[model samples]
Target: MKQLLFVLAFVATGLFASSQGAVKKYRVGIFASLYLDSTFTGSTYKFTNQMPKHILPGLDFVQGALMAVDSVNSNQPLEVMVYDLRSADQSLDKLRSRNTFDSLDLMIGSVSGAEYRTLADLALLKNIPFVSATFPNDGGVTNNPFTIIVNSTLPAHCEAIYNFIMRSNPTANLVYVRRKGTQEDRLASYFAKYNKGSNGSTLLKWKTLNLNDNFTQTDLIPHLDSLKTNVLICGSLDEAFGLNLVNVAQKIYKTYPMELVGMPTWDGMKDLTKPEYKDLSLFYTATFFNTGTVAATNFTKGFTDLTNGRPSDVAYRGYELTRFFIQLLLRYNTQLMQHLNERTYRSFTEFDFRPVLNSTSGKPDYFENKRIYILKRSNNLVSRMN
Candidate 1:
């Protein structure tokens, strides 16, 4: 009878252990500059002093995505810990003092370039995955095996813009107008390469304009009047310069018609809709959500319902990032870490993070949703060109 009791006790203990093991929990760390001052109240502002009250819709979007995933997967309760890194006085020391890094399975944020570098180092040391919802400005977190960029980089954007222009106007002459900064210069070089063999022959021309000193309509007016090209590409994000370019192009369009093309920075700028830019018919490239497709529309509605109708770029990014990660987790199950290292998530982007080495000579790779939208500005209204 004692032997029988011992066997039963062992069986009960094993069942309890199994049940406990099935209820696994995960903690995700969200480090961001969400605590901005109330002085800058707008859709783009990332921070506020109101505790959980005035936090932007982007935060809600991210939190909602995590919550939705957690609701269905009760086995693993995901606990998201947020770090408000918005103050100018904020430092890595404060982040370390919080001891928030101790139990983190993954880290996501739109930290400053410097803070991103620090977080990259910490993530590598801790062996945790890191995702950046915004552009980090420092050419991505290199050497960090666990870091993933949710937003497409500047180079990818440039490539997409180049391809779209080449396809749309095979015979059109292309002229690139750029500033003298590192980012601008890099894009200029990229355009040079693409224009060399982009279409049948080299039909693109390059022109450099000093954005600091000699950046006025007068400087580009002569070129515009003389050029046979009708398409003009601006490689700078300076809103002031963009406005000037648009103004100049509009004036020149009276006699010489031209099309202004820019990168993703052209989106959401209220200044572009002013009367001065009315004649500047602009075309630019943006991500899938910005294009307003059926899938994107449904997702946006779902996101708006969760966040009280406040939306922005970060909100869309958070939704897509969370959805992608959740899909990856469900598909790979326990082998997520392994599969990530092996570059298995090809559907996420055309260029899988793992298989594609970040080099120039490899496949003409681009991020997964390379669907570029040609946005045209007609009568100061922006619409997607079909």
Candidate 2:
């Protein structure tokens, strides 16, 4: 009788332990801008366009990924608390005051630069991880070892374009055409730095053209002839100016043929499809997501189904961000939170968040850069370039 009782007690203890080991939980906070007013059918939660309804598709993608994670690993179940900031006008205040953070483990936001700064400050103070889908201003939040930027930065895009130009046309003389704007100035500065090397000596020369003032290609005819350059790279974002440049360039092509290089703003600009741009080929650098690769296509399909066909940029942002976070949770479990401060993590777009520390001070100094994709558009067809 004593041996039978001992066996029963041992089995009960094992069963309890196994059950406890099979359950895991994580609390997450989603803070977004609500710019519109609408309600989900049959749900008490009202949604707005403050964050753009189109972004809902991406959000749905993330939800689907999370569900998949939960099914595969019953131990880790995610509890998400969403906060809308349209009415309050101060999302950070709401986030900080919320009782949810007491149990919250991670935060994801698709706010603007100003809002991102507010959240970054809060995340640093609380030692929590905050991921932003868009580019955050450089000075807004660095040094917060926990802040992660999923989108490629503007400067990184500039560098990628510079590198592509150097590698493809090592000795090609170039003419830089730009409108008088801060963006154009920045690109010019980057190109100057890129051409400082030995082989780049006189390899590139630029002629700045202000569309507002110059207005016509005839204004640039003299410079084009004097420079004797056959390549024109545009660094302006104004659609009107871009179209004007393309039109003028096409007219000139009848006499002086030149290849055109452009910035990522040209990606979906309808001006490129006009008859004036037919003879001109444009190339630019963009993150792989914009080009719609295999992974992007699959994600888009899953995202569309989840959002009931409402197309949104936020939806993709939400979906990919959630997918990546879920993967980290599955791989690292509770340890995933700890790895937030690390240098890098595998993302749909390859990302490395490893901190760069000052050698003597032993403090984080900067973030190591990652990869970017280059795209080329010719005759209305866009494709990855090498």
Candidate 3:
């Protein structure tokens, strides 16, 4: 049991607990769905070699948070407690009932779906600032003032995409291409709202092209233009659908001239850099961007040295999120939410946290980082678009 609990890192505060009563101690909880039950076999921990696929994100998050905590040069005692959401003895509800969250000042999570909702509830109940690290959707959480969604939601992505296209080429032949699905319908509706303004005027006209799962070049070529750049925006987050659209567009790009734009989910997709997908330009939006500064470079190097492999973008996000929030927690103390918009604690990306208010109550539902970056990929390289 002790060994299993060790799996959840009890990140030590630098130096011992100070004897002086004047020092204010800060504590943070790193919550992640690291399924430790799969490895704990009758009081014996197995799998000393390869970690399970599902565990990597949580593991990476923990490692990155550790790096941030270790890098802190403050004497202020900052203890980080990692909670495994899937742990049998320490599940979310169990810990919440045991008054675990009451001990922490902040909560950061890489969890989504049910786990996200649970954490949000806990945050609201305890009045602790909760950072939703990776989950884009708010998990239907409402009226939770403490919830801070780090990843921009689907509506936010849609707004970014619409604004980007409108800015670049409002008159350009814009075609919204998507697959037949429920999510596709929701994305389409969001796109339509942008086009159909409140004054009953169409700001921009775009043709919607619906394609099946087995769609080919014949299905996409008809909506594209041959004379000028046919701006094709993929409305679906389905990776398969997105790849097919790009591949089809790539075949006729020389003749039809395509400017490909994809959903925010395409930010970290390595498939877009394949040799076959080269030469064709692709644009996408992301809430987080790794600026690769001196700090970022050192983090990458240090991460590789520790893990003996390169860290994923999530790891970088974890490092930045933890570092920034922890610093803010120490500085502002109980007044952290009041200073959320202060751009002083610059990390890998600039965060613009604004209050999301309820329509009727006119009260904050939650705070969300509205800052999004429009990025471009061309010639096998990805960069921020001006």
Top lDDT: which candidate number? 3
For model 1, give the 10-residue run with minimal summed lDDT.
Answer: 10-19
Q: Name the regions of candidate 2 deviating beyond 4 angstroms.
A: 1-24, 35-74, 87-90, 197-214, 225-229, 290-295, 310-313, 333-348, 352-369
All models: lDDT?
0.57, 0.57, 0.82
Q: Which candidate number has the best TM-score? A: 3
lDDT of 3 at 105: 93
Q: List residue ranges in candidate 1 displaced over 4 A.
A: 1-22, 36-76, 86-102, 136-140, 180-183, 196-203, 206-229, 275-279, 291-309, 333-374, 379-386
TM-score per candidate, chains pooled: 0.69, 0.74, 0.92
For model 2, how does the per-residue alpha-carbon lDDT over 202-245 read when each residue is reduced to its tens digit? 55545655557346766767666533346677777666676677
Two-way TM-score contest, 2 vs 3, winner: 3
Give the per-residue lDDT of model 1 (tens digit) for 312-374. 666556555554554455455444445543333222222234322447555312122234455
The per-residue C-alpha lDDT of model 3 at residue 241 equals: 86
15 Cα displacement, candidate 1 (Å): 28
> In every candidate, how many clashes are there?
4, 21, 0
The model with the greater TM-score, 1 or 2, is: 2
Residue 197 displacement (Å), model 1: 4.9
Instruction: After superposing candidate 3 on the true structure, give the runs of residues whose Cα lies further than 4 Å from its correct spot.
Output: 1-22, 40-45
Global lDDT of model 1: 0.57
